[model samples]
Target: MAGFRPRVPAPADITMIAHHSVTLLFDLSDGADLAHDARGRYGRGSVAVGLLPGDFRASGRAGEVLQIRLEPVAAAALLGAPADLSGEAVPLEDVWGRDAAQAEDRLRAAGTWGERFTAARDILTRRLTELTRPDTRPPVDQEVAHAWRRTLGSRGRVRVGSLADEVGWSRKRLSARFSSQLGIAPKRAARLVRFDHAAHLLAAGRTAAGVATESGYVDQPHLHRDVKEFTGLTPAAVATAPWLAIDDLAWPASPPPAPMHQRP
Candidate 1:
């Protein structure tokens, strides 16, 4: 398989792991630092390639990045840890759990693609070893995630407050924990989830109006504002994206020019 490789300091530091698919990465070799900011409406802030909504912005590595194909939602679900690519060295515990230090060490020690790949796989496997087989009862956050998924499927919208209430957490407490673990706010996460739903509909050749309604936008104008704000482009621009092919190896792009809609 044609997997990507990570590097420490080189232009090729950030390489595409798969064709617009799940990204796998090899960290910096030895003591070299990796730097990059993953900024977008759909991706995690900064995290390992397997993390969902994670798009590689810029990184410094001399090694290789090994990657695989993964759907957006599946990628999001695998995010049981925290990731930060804000050009700041966020503590691992602040992002992941108490085990974050160990994971970071292992990742940093990984020098080659083989080493990093093995470490990543092992870390993920061991971390989620409890869920090797599905169970009726899961951790509270996981339960909350499930609930959010259900809400999205039914009403096509999710509010952080509702989820926090269900889990008996204050909004502040829940947001703090969620941001540390997921590298984004609960409300932003919900917005991305909603955007994902709309993206899928649009990709299926659905009209903007239809997609807006189905994905819970208040109206076409509202959808237009959302599409523009999330993506730097308009819906029409995205609709004609030339790289809109399956396995097309394209990053989601900004939309076309349109009048700015003020955020209420």
Candidate 2:
């Protein structure tokens, strides 16, 4: 979870790279708009952005935004739906209905960013609790969950075949189940995770060649191609991306633990 309020207006345009987690953006401004490839205009309010939305740009007046990134396992239960959000961004109202509006109202009513963050967390916690009650939905499979963790822990360098073998499932079965639950093939997820790590390294002043090797890319070109494919930007460009500049402030820690509402 992260809360952001710009002290000044936004820059010209900010290009975002694809990431491995589901993103929830709560708009707390009156005039700013969020636009993406799938949804041209995101009105003022809460918006749910799924994983791996390639190369989207956010352009409009600057404003306060509460951004939450959820792992797919927890996101599935919190969202009251399958984790098939890859390459998609939808209105929060579409997922949470009137509750979405209520949340926004509560956040708006809060006097401080701390208060707003608390309100948003409470709303999400309540929703997750309600959705997971009495078998309303199936939890993500243990094997699938393990695979996702392994991929992320390894910085996307894990071999899917080995993961499947470790989980006692065939490659085909693992791929199918992972895709069905997480909205992305296991192999593709690994690539995205790996690219995310490499992007951060590049941003931190690592040479492209070093980042490629350390991130498990075959070579610099392999890293470059993956960066381009996910972000529509070359490795050099991605190294200086403004979108990544705020990541440390927004998400300072490692991937968070599963929310209490999710099943073990």
What CA RMSD would you report for each candidate?
10.1, 5.8
Model 2: per-residue Cα lDDT over 1-264, one tens digit each:
766655556533445568898888776666435443444544434577788776555555546666788898888778754465677777777776777767777877888766776777788788877777775546778899999999999999899999999999999999999998888899999999999888878877789999999999998999989998888889888776666656563333323321111110
* Model 2 alpha-carbon drift over 4 Å, by segment: 9-13, 30-44, 82-84, 134-137, 250-264
Model 2: pairs clashing at backbone N, Cα or C within 3 Å: none
Q: Which portions of model 1 miss their true places by more than 4 Å?
A: 1-23, 26-80, 83-123, 126-156, 246-264
Q: After superposition, how far is residue 100 of candidate 1 from its true place, in Å?
A: 15
Q: What's the C-alpha lDDT at position 42 in model 2?
A: 47
Give one digit per residue, the lDDT tens place, for model 1 in 1-264. 123332233444342211212343323334334454443322222234433333334445434323333333333444333233222222234434566556657766666546665776787667556443475333235644554455455443767777778778887887876665445566665666676567666766789999898888888887787667655567776565432322222323334212111110
Positional deviation of residue 134's Cα in model 1 after best superposition, in angstroms: 16
Compare the candidates by lDDT and give the number of the best one.
2
The lDDT of each candidate is 0.48, 0.74
Q: TM-score for all predictions?
A: 0.51, 0.86
Clashes per model (N, Cα, C within 3 A) = 28, 0
Model 1 lDDT-worst window of ten: 255-264
User: What is the lDDT for 209 in model 2?
Assistant: 93
